[model samples]
Target: MITFYDILGIALAMSIDAFCVCICVGMKYNKPANYMRLGAAFGFFQFIMPVAGAYAGRLLMKYTGNIKYLAAAFLFYVAFHMFREAWKNKECKVYLSDPTVGVALLMLSLATSMDALGAGISLALWDGGIIWASCVIGIVCALMSFLGVFIGKRSRGYVGHYAEYFGAFILAVIGVRFVL
Candidate 1:
């Protein structure tokens, strides 16, 4: 059974990507409405992907027999990639001149929510409530994304980058916890 703490941790871990991208958007486009649009886009996708993944996971569960190990492995893989990205601190170009609500925002939202699909699969393996978990994930992501933009607008440099590292550590610990 997945506890509330576990769900919260996973949600936070998943939101890191959305948060980071929102920060970049915020830095480039400081419009208040743009922040809401970004948040809605990110949150909505984050909500949808997990539910889809959970359904897929349920379909596979009968054949797999045990999904805990798979979930742990997937979490570890996500954590590893997150850590790698944080270490590299790759430069991403955000077009300040471009419209905030269009293909670019849709693509960003889709990119960030991919991890939630994996997380949804993991949640299904753990017998988690996909709807509830997804709601929490969506709400948290929305709030984080909204806030990230403001933070980015106010600050410069790599101040918010540490969030990815922290999120990675949380995911890694959760993965190990599941294994043990």
Candidate 2:
């Protein structure tokens, strides 16, 4: 049986990616409405993708194992991208009024949260349902993303870059850990 602590751990770990991505999107976008939509999209996908992974794991193991590698690769890739973006010398104004940004945000959110999907596979293998886990992860990610966006919008200075770098480093370490 999954305890509340388990849920909290899973939620916090899963939400780290969302938190980092949300901050970047918030910095890149302007409309508050867009942030709301982005948050909802991230939360929804984070919730659903894990459940899907869990079900898929029940059907087979080879695919599930591949998912772990895929997720690790994605995390490292995104981490490096964030690092590069943050390190860039040019500063450009955000054109957030465009809805196309939402697609990009969605893709970023999905990429960063892929590890949680594989974790869900482990849960399914253990015969543990993801309902509780998903609820915790979804809610935590929504809130963390909201906070991250709000902070990014307000700070827009040294702190945001630091956070991005830190997230990227963490993702790199996690990816290496997964590979080894």
Candidate 3:
């Protein structure tokens, strides 16, 4: 029987990606509202994905094993973009940096939540309810990502021009983790 502690631990573990990605976003922008928005996006994905995985785990896996690779590819692409932006002499572009908005937001949310999806597959076997666990995970992810953004924003000046580079490195590491 899974306990609340177990769920909390899982939530913390799963939120790392969102937190890291949010730190990246925070580096470029100091807006707290945007940080929450990014966190919400991640939280929403984290919430839905695990439920999807719990219900549709085996069914979906049969159709494709490339989900991990696809996620990794997206992360790597995003990371590469970040690295490029960091290297450029001009001001960083808005589209990629402001991941609180469109496709970039969705992709990052999906990529980061992949692990939560995997965790959900195991949740099917546990006596603990899926909804409650997913809720906790979502809330934790939102909070952590928000905190990451704040921290990143605070550290921006200290990091100087390399903030994007660090963020990109974090994303790349996350990508590599998804693959292996």
What does candidate 2's lDDT look like per residue over 34-64, in tens digits? 5677677777777887788677666665544
lDDT of 1: 0.84
**If both were scored by TM-score, which would come out higher, candidate 1 or candidate 2?**
1
Better of 1 and 3 by lDDT: 1
Q: Positional deviation of 43 in candidate 3, in angstroms? A: 0.6
Clashes of each: 0, 0, 0
Q: Write the per-residue lDDT of candidate 3 for residues 1-180, one digit (tens) a residue.
A: 446765665577567667766665787865867887888999998898778766664454457643556555655775676577557623322244567887878898998888677667645545567888899989999898888788667764333235556656766666666567
Ranked candidates, highest lDDT first = 1, 3, 2
The candidate, 1 or 2, that scores higher on lDDT is 1
lDDT of each: 0.84, 0.63, 0.69
Per-prediction TM-score to the true structure, in the order listed: 0.94, 0.63, 0.65
Candidate 2 has which clashing residue pairs, if any? none
TM-score of 2: 0.63
How accurate locally is residue 98 in candidate 1, as Cα lDDT from 0 to 100?
Answer: 48
For TM-score, candidate 2 versus 3, the one ahead is 3
On TM-score, the leading prediction is 1
Colliding residue pairs in candidate 1: none
For 1-180, candidate 1 gives per-residue lDDT tens digits of 679999999999999998888777777786878888988999999999889988888877878777888888888988988888888885545665644678988888899999899888888866556899999999999999998888778764255568889889988998898788
